[model samples]
Target: MRSFVRVAERGSLSSVAREYGVGQSTITRHVAELEQALGVTLLNRTTRRITLTAEGARYLDDTRTILRLVDEAADGVRSATDRLTGTVRISCTAALGVRHVADILFAFQDRHPGVCVDFRLSDVQIDLVREGVDVAIRLGALSDSSMQRKQIGASRRILVASKEYLDRHGRPDEPGALARHAIIRMSNVSGSDRLVLHRANAEPSILPVGDRLLVDHGLAARRAIMMGRGIAPTHLWLVNDLLEAGIVEQVLPDYSPEPVPLSILFVPGRARVKRVRALIDALHGALRALPGMT
Candidate 1:
């Protein structure tokens, strides 16, 4: 299981084998043997990337849980093992990875010096099996398919404008009025297909609006909105600090967004593992402890 986890985390068969002082072919043989034992193919090998099959993805989550238990038991022979002594390879978007996720990870490392973390931050989507990332913090809604996920945090899209911009143009009274305002927006595969604006008791209205500034990254969009360049439909979590500082005002409050959100995604086997479980549980505990969670 450790070898399998290491290969999955490292992504390249050769890389994991080299780390363990073996040839790539040997690592390949080991993975093949494991796959045969499980009666499932875990990776779809390609020249460019290794993709996880649904079965493989599911296996990873559980494998993670099993590994943690084994480690915890080993630790019980001596220490309590608050120091979860191993390397955790995590991947998340560039912006949040640096600002928020990295903070939490670094703190985890500090408290558990026996454990090391290998983190990769990028805006691009990655294949977990191929990239060898143990966990991926993905933003926005999930797909209409079968990948396991947990809520690391809850996030929503809100209309926001700089104080200067709101003062100059006035806040939007309703979703319909946004048509007349300049907007900065993010449209990606991970984001919603259409925008839904909600009021307290009334049904939410869907809008098809154009953007003066269109970006794929949340951080850049947030920066533009903070500068008062244009009003923006943004990820609430990314702009939480700015909103609190009174630098940005929430507009169209009555017509807030519906249930678009943020989540942590991984192959199911990883979620079942002890180290991964520890991280997932820590995230779940931390997030639920946040204000205004449903």
Candidate 2:
């Protein structure tokens, strides 16, 4: 049915075959089987093109509606089931995946061995539908309002540097002084060229930042800071361990960037899947347990 729908919509058997990653003969056979089952000619084929017969035109609309309802029914059944069992495709930033999400996934897998997880860790934002991702863990503000979101916790970005770097370069006394210090910039996020600092009951301060080093991954930026390359703004959770161990210290402690919201995003109907719902619940609980997460 999916193949037929694709063929009808695209108006080419070969195109549908490529979309499905199957041979053209397979798509031809699928349509042939459907026609045979229905005992009616659904499409008129010429040497160069295929056109839907009148019967095919009417059937196509009904088929699309049927397919939609079928999917909804399956989702409903999955949502009501007690046992969660299926593959869940998830995407998250590389730093968060390495530092935190991996452990949460392991624990969830341990509890529900029947569930399989396809985890893709990258800094680039992925299209949930196009990428077939069931869930995405996003940090900071969400731009796509189409996806359903559940705020799990909050993450604050703060200026941090290695003790060695601080001792040598000296800490900035205020937001304005940051211009004199070398800055490690995260290339993946927006506003890397500027620092916006906020404090309680005070107007926000903005200062242009110089990029001494730029990295694509948060972990890479953190490494640059720890190597005494420069000071960088980072999520508090990412550097919490290093802070406790006296490896790195927060700079300009009096001011911090506005806290970025941490959220789990999914397609509208995806939350109805049992496996997705289970994972979301597990992740929410895990994130709440982390230090400095609200």
Index of the highest-TM-score prediction: 2
Q: Per-residue lDDT of 38-156 in model 2, one digit per residue for the tens? A: 99988888889888899998998788678656655765675665456767889998998999999999999998887989899978888776565779999888899999998887886
Cα lDDT tens digits, model 1, 77-131, are: 5355344666667878876675577777767666667666788888877877656
lDDT of candidates 1 onward, in order? 0.72, 0.84
Deviation of model 1 at 190, angstroms: 6.1
- lDDT value, candidate 1, whole model: 0.72
TM-score of 2: 0.77
Model 1 residue 288 distance off true place after TM-score fit, in angstroms: 2.7
Residue 121 displacement (Å), model 1: 2.2
